[model samples]
Target: MESSAAKYCCDNINNHGSSSQSQTSTCMQKFRLYETRSNFYMIGRDKSRTYWRVLKIDRLDPSELNIREDSTTYTESECSELLRRIHEGNISTGGLRFVTICYGIVGFIKFLGPYYMLLITKRRQIGSIRGHNVYAVSKTEMIPVPNATVNSSIADSKDENRYKKLLCTVDLTKDFFFSYSYHVMLSLQKNLCNNEPGQFLYETMFVWNEFLTRGIRGHLQNTLWTVALVYGFFKQATLSVSGRDFKLTLIARRSRHYAGTR
Candidate 1:
């Protein structure tokens, strides 16, 4: 791919602008989560902080995932004012409370009762390939969409706790990394030469969050709210060979198809 095209796609992850005729960047890199009694308002912005968008998650229903994306793109000040309005409108039942700042949505999952949202709360840069930064998950959070009062009975069940524990054992912070701009799962040659649809990238075998992100991606028809994490290994090192210095980078991607046999 051309450097200019890559940069344009990276900087404008959602491919939308503030106006119908003018095209501006809305990367959706950083997110601020706010919540009222019945809903979650996720505000996302680009790295430059010039463009912004909103995602609404309904918290009233435990059995289903309800997510809606606001079609308009806002300026920083306008986005803040919109948030203020939401806060003031919901002031009767504790107002809109600040939840947490997250880098990207890992995905949404559920057990027997309510659904839970997985968020990447912290990330650390590991390396970069062709000007695209790659990061490993430093910290993560799995928060139930519905409050404790809504799913009190099922939330406290033994089976539910056990399932949660089982999921935690995977330890996402260990050997997973992703890039908001680059398609890490694809080989370097393919990434450079192929101009595949964004949806095809997510549907590949290497993306660990494929199934988890399907619901929201299907609903909004875009991937502005999540990141596709790749599980396996990554390492970079410098070495001396024949009295000359050399650099080596290794990436190992785990295959989900034949995971347990060998």
Candidate 2:
């Protein structure tokens, strides 16, 4: 069904009536809050190693939302148009629903609305942080969160210098680190107290940048709510009575002080 909100956008575009930005979103409430509320979409998966997704900010329409269930599948390029139209859309109706859905954001460098994001692609156990196994970044990928309208590769002759310079600054195979469920940043004492059954926070405020962490304060946070902090790729595993092709991802949550495996 065509939502009243989306319908209004088409109407407002045709009429060009002066409408307040807040009022426009209020009119879009039905479609925006439900279908387009998610921060990302699982576009597709291939074998066990490759996966794809599109940030919500890149989407053109809320009705296009496709969340892969155990039985669903997608292609890597399925959402490329969404990425392409990000720069093409007209905002005459009102402010566009764009947010860089990212977390664990580091670096002081800012590009307009979003900060550059780093994802750990490969990891190797280097040592222990307070008895917790800390893995070093063996591989990584740099992804610009917002629509930067520029290529990251040096292949573009016009942007070769600019892209090359930015690309040269990162070497993901070193220094970066991560541990799935371990609070490697905090000490064992504090972490132990954190997981004492009821004290663990659903959201960690400090991990978020000052701009976003403020509003989310004193509220329950979940991995789903902070999908931007997620690592490399999100895979969709689908299953059916006929057959199960989706690979199972096992996330083991251990108690404090008890180190878990990958």
Candidate 3:
């Protein structure tokens, strides 16, 4: 627990606080833009340029921004028309902390209060001793995709404020944890605990149970695979056997749930 806490603290310090305006400017150090007949792609880099991000832009009606209604769906033609108008107009966010496009489709969850969007704010690379690099989720930001409208009446009860407070009270760095690299257990008790349906199981589906998918989640969406290290555990050495050089080989079957770490 101490190590986890320390690491979290150090990561925040390393990021110099997620809210710093300067970080947003460097969020995408250098970027490349690509487009297909069906989609538009934006590949971004951090200030270091060692890091990379790929996002997709969606063209939807303003009304569709509200995640509450299920009826708000866009057909392929409409989506393309929207994309067509965007690039044709050369409209861009320019340099804002916000990205007009989306990164990838990890998934989203439905809740009672509001539609919450989990976005990766910053990612930290853990080490690549095994000739491969692994990254951990260094930071994230939560944006609420609001519905039509909440009761903004002057006579509205205090419960509205309380509800907002409840959501705002969450300290994502401490309360919610994520790592693109490894399955960091939540707690010892949780590790020993059997999961129920629709819970935080590693390979569960409902976490991202949403129809509105966009971004780097292409025909081959395998970004999550980057976090796992397959067989770095086995050490290799050469030896002389009968005056002949010999190499050792070990085969391992990775776990389906959490395959990378071994």
Quote each prediction's TM-score. 0.86, 0.33, 0.33
Query: What ranking of all candidate models by TM-score puts the best one first?
Result: 1, 2, 3
Residue 255 lDDT, candidate 3, scale 0-100: 41
**Over the stretch 4-25, how does candidate 2's per-residue lDDT look in tens digits?**
4443333322243222222211
lDDT to native, each model: 0.78, 0.32, 0.33
* Best-fitting candidate, scored by lDDT: 1
In candidate 1, stretches whose alpha carbon ends up further than 4 angstroms from where it belongs are: 1-26, 238-247
Tens digits of per-residue lDDT for model 3, 183-251: 232232543564432123333321221232322122113232112112222233567899999655232
Candidate structures ordered by lDDT, highest first: 1, 3, 2
Model 1 clashing residue pairs (backbone): 1-192
lDDT of 1 at 206: 83
lDDT, residue 109, model 1: 89
Best by TM-score: 1
